[model samples]
Target chain A: MSRPKRQLMMGNQACVQGALRAGLRFYAGYPITPSTEVTEGCARELPKTGGRFLQMEDEIGAISAVVGASVAGVKAMTATSGPGYSLMVENIGYAYMIEAPCVIVNVQRGGPSTGLPTKTSQSDTMQTRWGPHGDYTAIAVAPSTVADTVTETIRAFNLAERFRTPVTILLDEVIGHMQEMISLPEPGEYQVVDRVKPTCPPEEYEPYGSTDNFVNPMPAYGDGYRWYATGLTHDAMGFPTNRPDEIVVNLDKLRRKIEDFRDEICKVRADWMDDAEFALVSYGSVSRTALLATKLAREAGVKVGCLQLQTVWPFPLAQLRELLQDCTAVIVAELNMGQIVREVERVAPPQARVHSLLRYDGEILTPIQFLEKIEEVRS
Target chain B: MTTTAESVAEQRRSDVHLSYLRPHKKFPNLWCPGCGNGIVMSSLVRAIDKLGLPRDEVALVSGIGCSSRMPVYLDFQALHTTHGRALAFATGVKFARPDLKVIVITGDGDALSIGGNHLIHACRRNIDITTILINNYIYGMTGGQVSPTTPSGAYATTTPFGNTEKHFEPCDLAKGAGATFVARTTVYHTPQMDRVLADAIAHHGFSFVEVLSNCHTYFGRLNRLGSATALLQMFKEKTTSVGKTEESANGKIPIGVLHRDLETTELCDEYQKIVDSLSKGKQG
Candidate 1:
């Protein structure tokens, strides 16, 4: 392959490049702080590629339009911050129920409502998992660097299409706005997954019927295989059903589609854990601090390692359990008040004590602060 | 004693039945016997049939209301979306695939109350989609609540003491919001409803058609508008055609094509121009 072209890119711009590479042809978003650059980049680049970008009236409309475009057989996406993400939760649930393949990028800002629009926080960690009401599984990924933003976004869209559901890319303001120099991936360096289309004739097509892999092939509108799509609980034929047996079967399929493939869906990166007594578990922008803290501690004759979670949901519990087996303790670091730490506490081995290092003052956790917390947690 | 013309009429009726409707789904829709929603649905189907578009090429989208359920019985690519958000979804569909003929079916409350922002923006954008707003003057699906188009002093379940708010004129709202085409007709005016719907569909930009329908089971019973038949009679008597160019002495509202602007560029087409220009700049 020819030499990869190098470019200085913001994290949000990297996300747009990744989406374009993943076949994103439509974007509908309402501008919000710390996340507006993603929309702006899409507005400038998507049209140049013959793709469409729309600034919706509100975040709800943004997500609703994204779902609609996905149903119409276009790879689509939207970006927003905390306040807009709150408005998008309803349609996010709708996309899940209808099994539409789409991606939602939440560059999280602090708050219950419109808090710290310009600052970064990882407060949406839990909300990304259970924001929409009901018993359903979610797939979310976090990127620690501008380059990872591009790769993770491509992975986000791939996972959405693979599972036939909406995927969330959980970003924080730091990663979304921070500038970094990186080389764009050469063509064919990364794999792109498209939604599987039906091979059966129109008369025999069932939009919701399970395939061998449990994911149903999606047929877009205006295709010869026209079908009804709704947020209602539906049967194999894609028609609404209230039958008790059908409801169980339908809901169970939605859960199992992601859970059954957890091995392939979950991802994490472990560094320098070969001979450590303690480790730092981190994700998103906080992982950068954790990495630097580990390096400083290791040089000073302290045995410390870092585990960065790239895929936040499906929790990567088994991987965490295995990685923490030899360690005596694990420090969970994040920008929020002990969100993912709770998950670490739940999944860490019984012999490993779990502690949290949280910083939620609209400031990123620094390496010095993390090193200090490591000493305190170890003591 | 059957003539050739009668035979031809019979054949046309059968052709419409076999061509447009889903036969397997239970006969007679879930609407009430005298509900004007059925009349509106028939008019829509007839309009599409008259346009001669393939069923696969037409996608009908609707929100949560009595009128929104019209898509379920028709054989088209249909999406029954969330309450008050059908226009937003249809906008996405049209933008993604401008080749498809997109149509939205909504009601007064669904379009003017909870979904008011989307409705006005849709008109303002002038996207190439046809919106049919069914104005029954009450929220029939949710059991006779006061709607934005509910006339002042009207008795609704929520407005037990009579509604105190002024009613909305949907056609005026659409026209004010820059809709390329706007029209109004009633269920009682069957031929006029069909013609207006067809014209709205044929219009190359955003088009809004407000159908003044009746909900005798809710709105009429609460306000004592007699029976469904009496409500239909009232519509027939109270609606004056805009083509007449004279005001009705009985204070009837005008019904007919109220606004049309063929010169303004449609939104999707304008976006395509941007795409083309950007591509040219990149290549150059």
Candidate 2:
């Protein structure tokens, strides 16, 4: 790749760049604090790429439109914050059931309901995966910095198209609004995945037909594959089914299709994990501080390492378990009240003393805080 | 695609309207016998047939309701979405491919109460999607509850003490929200409904057609309105249509096209202009 275009830009603007580079042709979103920049950016940039952008009346309408566009075989996305994300959870479940490919960006602000509007909060960690009521699986990615936001967004689109499911990019106010200097990815720098199209003739095309990869090909609406899509449990023929056997097959496929490729879907990056006795685990903006703590702790003659979890919901359990297997103590740094720390507890070695460095005061955790947690665990 | 029923296939050869339906999926449909939903469905299918739009280019989006079940029985790009969200989804489909004829099938509660915000904004945007709001006055699929359109003093399950709420005139809402084409027709008026719906679909911007359907099982029985046939007869007597009238409908729910503004810009066409201007800007 001829050296990626180096420039400085805000995180939300980079996300739009990534989405446009991945060939997103349709976008519908509502403005919500901390995430409104994403919506505003799409409105400004989408038309430049010959894509259509709409500001919906609410988050429900925005996400509903996004799902509709995806079902119509267009790469689509929407962005919002806490209250809006809650409103969208209903349609998010519908998107999951219908197996539509789209990306949803949630630049989190604090909330059970309209918490801090301008501050960063990772309080929506579990909500992103379980917000929608159902047994359907979810794939979500968390990017730590402004530059990586571009690549992570492209990856989110790829994963959504690959699994034929709606994927989420969990950003917080800090990363979403933070400005950074970096080069944009060159046009062939990253692989882009488009929605799979039917290779068979229209007459034989089954919208939910089982293929070798488990994801059935989906065709654009006007492409002559006039198949059915519904929020109800549907059979392989794309028709709603009450038959227990067909219903089980329908629901099971959603979970199995993504889980089968778990190893490929889950991404965890390890730093200095060769022989560390103390490990710090984190993701998104929190991971940046976690990594800094690991470095400072090493200089201070303490053997500490950091594991950044890029893929939040396929949980990355096996990788976390293996990397933390040798550690005597594990510290989980999060901007929430111990959300992913529970995941760390599940995988930490039995002898490993797990500690949670929690902060949910509408502010991000610092490296000193992580360092303090490790020191406290030692005492 | 589902397997075709042989009998259904045989019936298609006998009737041109049968060709518009799905091969076998929910062949008989789930609506009760003599339900007005069937009549509206027939009228909608006939209008689509008259338009000669290819099934491939047609997308029927519906929310959850008895009336919203219209899409599953038809052979097109059918999407049965969440309750009260059909228009929102159809907006996406229309903007994504303005070439595709996107039509939203919704009911009174689905369109007015829970989905009311979307409907108002959709009309305001003047998006190119034909919305058919089937007003049965009560929620038929769910046990008869007091929907937003349940007439004042009408009895519903939730309104067993008789309704204390005023009702909504759907055509008025459509016109007030800036829909380019707005119409009201009863299921009893099939010829009027078919022609009105066809004209609405032909209109360039957002089109809303209110179909006054009968829910004899709950709405009619609870109100002591006699049988489904009696409700159909009532529609014939209660409504008056004189094409476009500025006068108060003389206390009648006026039928036929209530409002039409063909010159108003459609959302899709305007978006296309923006897209064209940008591409041209890039070239220049």
Candidate 3:
């Protein structure tokens, strides 16, 4: 009934705000630079809402705790930087295999291994999808601004709960620490999805029962479901199975649950190229650079547009291919050394040429930088 | 649903522990025929059966090992997790759902080696979860590799010449890590293990029970320990109950509840108090 409050908050702070808004009841994480604020925020806020927060000894424990908490029927989350994210890949794979819904926020820093802690880099772009081993798909949401971080985080939880899979909120150091004014959404402004519980009685309930959509309702521990969860490939009853037929069924559900409905899962922000000749494709804070560059290109009569990716994983190639259909030249600008550019090259129309604007010095990509790359590739 | 009431009664009378096991799960278990892990698992089942905890209200969590396989056969809300990380997961389960009883089954390598960090931290927090560390002195599942509990001069697949590192006593490690309740027993002492486990579950804080089980197939074959019976005899001769005059003087392993501190607040309860106080503060 009343207008929502507007306040200046860091991107990490907004993430905590968004997680709490989405009914996060459990958080477990270890401290990492550029993402420590997220852990601190949850620690201070979770107990206030009667939710539990824990600072596990290390990243493995942090990720493990989140999966454990999620199984016990709480909306759970964890945040970390590149090093911690590396420690979490194994359990992220575990979470995928068991089909536990949770959110992981990687406020990415420069890295092969801890390249730069305080500086910004999107080097972990590919790691977000492929870090966890085996056959599975991941849903990732990338927010370019502080305010967008809040909504994207809520969406991350929603996607995780919707498909019953772990979703990643990928941010770089620039956005994670950057402060901006965010008008917090009132209740009913943005939808919050709670975990899906089985309607069937505890006895008849099959935790991994097949459905047309490939998603089965999840029941929390101690709710009389007495369901089993294992990292091993499991059958319909949630017990481990090594049979070829059963393993295929277990692996297929993970891929199809998100892939079959990617139209609902992927989000992108595209602008300024109704009849443009050149385009800039980017995500995270680089999209902010791409937006400014497109505006500058338009004023300079350079006929360039920008496509900002809000969701990076599952590639969003189909949507991107459609967006770039009219363009002759595309510049994929990012802080990493051409991570997302590789994906753009695959989707660029056969007649179109995809150019890369890369930065790996742990710094932001500037508008002038993206514009220069566009002009060079155009000529 | 097909199980008849008369058949259920027959099963309960024949083997009470089988009634607690999952009807659909592959049972008789995957442990080797003469494995000490089987005895250890049955003791756990008996302990839970005696405690009268509801099946739906208890969660069995385990890491990868011969001992970790215990959860697969249980009727409880079971979680078969990665190698060496069951305690970390169990901490989350218990912390999030404090009303549910959480138990962790791990082995020497799973708990003390790969998962050592989680084990120590779980003890330090004193969360209301019970951990059963089944020490077989070698990595049985991985085919008898030397483990943290393997003696300095013991033989294993990797330690063909003999193990060179000093062995770890699991109970000592638990106590050092600030576990609120610590106990040690062997498969040979089934009654003591059953009693110790039930008490450990009843304890209001983190309870660590070290179970010295024999890996007759691996550790025994590699070293010259003979049959499962010989290993059981060795346990009887090697261990004595805590605080017995003549037995204590025999320089044997102490088999009993070694340490218990009831005064310290558990992790979940303290966290609840914080949550309660905050809500009260808001109201006032």
Ordering by TM-score: 1, 3, 2
Instruction: Label model 1 with its docking quality class.
Output: medium
Off by over 4 Å in 2: A1-4, B1-14, B243-250
Clashing pairs in 1: none
Model 3, range B1-284, lDDT digits (tens) per residue?
A: 55698888867744877687787777567788889988887888888889888878899999998899888787889889999999999999999999999999999999999999999999999999999999989999889999999999999989899988998889999999999999999999998999999999999999999988888999888889988999999999999888778745578888999999999899998999999999999999
TM-score of chain A of 2: 0.98
Shift in Å, residue A218, candidate 2: 0.3
Tens-place lDDT digits, model 1, residues B33-87 = 8899988888888898889988888998999989998887888988889989999
Q: lDDT score, residue B59, model 3?
A: 94
The sequence of per-residue lDDT tens digits that candidate 3 reaches over residues A17-116 is 9999998999999999989999999999999999999999999999999999999999999999999999999999999989889999999898888779
Which residue window of length 10 is worst by lDDT in model 3 chain B?
A: B10-19
Better of 1 and 2 by TM-score: 1
The global Cα lDDT (0 to 1) of model 2 is 0.90
